[model samples]
Target chain A: MSAFSTGAVTLAPHRVAAMVLRYLYLLRSSWTRLLELIYWPAVQLLVWGFLQFYIAQNSGFFARASGVFIAAVLMWDVLFRGQLGFSISFLEEMWSRNLTNLMISPLRPIEFVCALMIMSLIRLAIGMVPVTFLAIAFFGFNVYGLGLALAAFFVNLILTSWAVGIVVSGVLLRNGMGAESLAWTLMFVLMPLACVYYPVSVLPDWLQVVAWALPPTYVFEGMRALIMEHVVRVDLMVEAFVLNALYFSAGVVAFLQLLKSARRVGSLLQTGE
Target chain B: MSQAAEPAIAVDQLVKVYKTTRAVDGISFALEPGSITGLLGGNGAGKTTTIAMIMGLVTPTAGTVKVLGAEMPRLRYHVLHKMNFESPYVDMPHRLTVRQNLKVFGRLYAVEDLDGRIAALAREFDLSEFLDRPTGKLSAGQKTRVALAKALINSPRVLLLDEPTASLDPDTADWVRAHLERFRKERGATVLLASHNMAEVERLCERVIIMKRGRIEDDDTPRRLLIRYGRETLEEVFLDVARGRGEAREAAQ
Candidate 1:
């Protein structure tokens, strides 16, 4: 390589954001990958919507069950996709050894974590629009909270998923590709246990404690409070917000630590690539 | 600094140990820029280990690596866009088409007039026909070309290639070398090539460094080493260094 007194390369946050937006754009442009994220969850929503309609007739909530359920499904659908985002992304870079190349770049640990979170948020955001419309048309799903609950759910979904996202990244960094699938299933199982729709009080007291322990439980409750009761429930939102931030912040710190460690391992094993 | 001067790449008193074994032990060398230095050694020769450290992908246990005049794993990023690397040890995404892969990197590199850049590269590398195909479908040689294209996307200042032309046929290999030579001439990028192909290195590299068991054993111009070691050509000289018979030259020196 010849030498040049080149200009300094500055790392721009907006550039990183644009890179993230482009990834989201790619997801939107690709029908199959986008569909994959929404399809199965959409099916589950449809089946559950019909079943709820049969069980609760002429009920004000029943008439609106489909829409709310669709919303709930749309909200929860992000779980798998977001977890997949956290898990599979690292594997892709690692497998390609692009991780090595990227680490060498101006992209710092914060940038990496931030980019992943942004990607997940974008997946949840764009993918929800069509599912929302589909639910409204097909099953007469309740759109009562279309404006507010959806927005609240949007913020909460991103925050909580980030919490889960932190844990997932930790797992992926520790193990190779092995923990990624487990990370996916972890969310699939945890959301239901978190009682995304029904309140934790409906469950046994011990299970309720477990539900309260999960960040999704707070988010779901915050959504229900905003939609069902029109109450601010600032306490719940504050708690959920703090918890999500804690999870994400801690995850980022841990991820950075993992990265620092990974660099050493990468230095040793990631050679020659 | 007197004789062991201006290494295009340098590692000093390097040491990295896994849970059990020391992968690299006190290895050091500096490569002069504008040269293709070969880092040759066996599977666990610490060749890859050393490269990772230089790339800032791996943190050294106790050592320092300086690449392109910056202490690496720290200032690596400042010089990142100026450098590029390719290795058969790493694979590209199979699901994405070659053009898609190129686009992603092209954007990341912020290449000017990205479409035009990709078009020129696709043609220059003879990758036009398979550009739209998924990378998984391409023959090994084609994959190497795409990887190389990605490496050159930034018009790098430092190029580290590990077994760069491994899977290509002789014609394509020669073509790749010619393009590399052109890039070096035009861009003045420093190149450190690690390969098993002695002929490729001899043809492309102005200087060479051979490693056995994680330490540099021979550092010289390929032609002088060939004649000084009393070998007809560089390839034969490689066998002597690799197989433990080239030590006599070091002792004589």
Candidate 2:
């Protein structure tokens, strides 16, 4: 069993890398792609950083925790960019009418998803790393102070975003280009429930229940605790990880199932059209 | 167990029904190994749908499609690497250069010594000069060559081509046809070509399967189809098939 499992594991990466390289080649060949990756996130940081500064100067509640808004915006972008990176890479295949070519290749749908996840990581890194440095240099607020907990929060948020991204990709596969807008707008639909800049307690009773259901709420609430109270909450981190595990599993299952239906309906070939 | 003599492609009672339309209905045929066969039909005649089913891109509503003796959409991955497809309707990523697009597909197909393979295809297709140009920037004929090169990257034994030389001038189209013939001869590849150009089909295919309204209206060699229709060319015979006269001619024969 061990030998068989190991052999199976060894065969998947090259295929996945091939899919990632498809996008990497695009990113390398197009200066515009590279520019777009870094441009918008930096602009978001600069704009939101000014807002945070203005709030810090004007509000006594914000004055005590000067970096909270900046940290929230940066973390929120981590989730946004992670999700957008994944979905948009899939969209690129559709836009180029290349999905049929990829689908017909030896690459399986699951492997395609794996490649999308890896591409998302690469894109998120390209998009977020420079902005993270800019936050420190421009706002004098370093998000890395969250230490090892920062990595935990980032993983949970990214995984949750991936869960959303997979579902959106599945929808696009089944519905065609008419559903392309979901790649950009789906994450925002969950923003209010995520409690990115505030505590869950700030929401109404019913709304708080909905907020608790989403894994990112715990990450942001934990971020708030760590940044404002200087308390390390392992319970919140554990809860976020568990919820993400459930959401990620469901997302993958849904995506794969939808892909099967798309194939049956001949929607996979029509995706690019 | 599959024997070596099993046909390269076998479709038995294949059917694909979309909501209100039966795109491909109960079609059955088999292509011998190393043979070049043509799938001919006018628009909406189910040629694309049948090819899509053969590639495992579209699942059949009923019946079976077995490529390289493996039942498809189920055992697709087992044989997919051994096959490749080309269609003017689909494209590679346009922003990437021709070389970049080829390299990516070569890797996806896990073609060994990919750089060598890309170099060979570029030379064979005369793509070296524009290899670094973005695919979208290339002229239509150049893009068609790149698409064909991408399809051949895996050295696929089974090739499915749709309108391979569509929208090209006669010289380029004839050049593309000659290259396909050479690829078949050199690789012993089994080709299922769908083309509207009856002349290209007559020149390249050993046998022809003409479809109409999701059914195989006629299946024979190009010469046999011409004789059966009492026509001078495959184009006239194709017109007879498209206008639903081929069925009557076949019944009369």
Candidate 3:
């Protein structure tokens, strides 16, 4: 029997909800926090929409595919929001010096991750939805025009971002709060390799090898395929899913391993400092 | 089979070595059910490390920690709901209200009738007025009360506390100690308290374990330790232990 099915061990929904409620209370209590959830994505959308329009008028490549850059920017926010939400939520516990309290509770590592995943989803929706509507109104581009493929691309990209978030959180755990910068920089390091605003072919042959290894590369490439050629690439979606599965597994393993290391070093209690 | 009735907490040869310095050298002790034991030590004496190990927050280098009869860092999940920890060094989310913090912890521990529990704790801790305020805005005494309320949210059988009354004024600190005494009497909880306040230990702890250089130097009741060191108070006994006079006394004995 699975751990969840057995009475011996199971992820308590109430405990997970408590974790989620903790973050919700923070968001609800602070107007700045609530504003922050939507501010950056809206600014990014407006700025990127103007850039896309400028490029579309001046650049021959973008002129032919007017919506590609706008679409890419909106889609990329999904990934960025996913990674930031997960890592920042974890950082909140450290900043508050509440990790020791949570660790000592009956909440399991997997359950904690699950809570962060839920929080990331809430953050992503709060951050991205308004911006997405702005993209349509301002750029004359609706990423939703990609239809059902947008959902597939979104799931793959967010899951891949979650994988990156897990690895960064592991770094924070194994090291200390000094490594917090990794939470913001780790995903952007993959941006060039992810080919977020460009196609994989634009990169040199050697770098293209690295790009192809990333799940987001397939996602953006698939986005370009749908936007530029109106072709749905099933193979790219499959490749992204397979790679996401592997990266997520490795990320979880790395996170759990680092948690054990942190415990051995007694860093869990001293994390905030 | 005969070891089935394990004490509330049992540490066997617990050791935590950090690179070169041994934070918690080989040590062993146990706390009987419903007893409040003080773990006393000076700076760098490993009281926090020992308490962390007992709470399964730190993995011992070469020993076992069994809490509530389950080997820790392994079966910690099985008994975690039955154990809770509190420390003034840690804080709850600053943006959360005191009541929200308590509610979060109460739900996490799956305490039944959580609203009732929070109301009761707020009344008991005199937290009703400030419970609606953000935790960061509360005074230190109020925050301490909230922390203690969070610790007891689970009504845990084993409670690990580190300087539970570190910075409070004399009257508030005394009140906190009295409440802890009431908690022990009412709940029959096993407490492993780590503190530098000798009077607090002397008053609340039935037995005291004095530690130095990551090892236990003496384990005795407050009265016995005072007699053994020819000291009038536990503070004097603590001073002698911290100054390494306990070793000299042992040699002379």
Q: How big is the positional error of residue A148 in model 1, measured in Å on the Cα after superposition?
A: 2.6
DockQ (CA atoms), all models: 0.40, 0.68, 0.72
Which segments of candidate 1 are over 4 A away from where they belong? A1-18, A21-30, A58-71, A85-101, A104-106, A144-146, A202-210, A226-232, A267-273, B1-7, B95-99, B128-134, B247-253
lDDT of 3 by residue, A110-139 (tens): 889999999999999888888888887887
Interface RMSD of each: 4.6, 2.8, 2.5
Clashes in each model (backbone N, CA, C under 3 Å)?
18, 0, 0
| Candidate 1: tens digits of C-alpha lDDT, residues A1-273 | 122223543345643653475455446445897777667766777787776667667677756433445556666776556666655554556555555545544455555666777776666655555666777787766554456545555566677666677666655655555565766577777766778767778999878887876777876776666656666666776676677777777776776676667676654243223
Q: Using TM-score as the measure, which candidate wins?
A: 3
Q: Please, what is the TM-score per model?
A: 0.85, 0.96, 0.97
> Residue A145 in model 1: shift from native, Å?
2.3
What's the best-to-worst order under DockQ? 3, 2, 1
Q: Please list all clashing residue pairs in model 3, or write none if there are none.
A: none
- How large a fraction of the reference contact set does each model reproduce? 0.41, 0.95, 0.95
Model 1's chain A TM-score stands at: 0.79
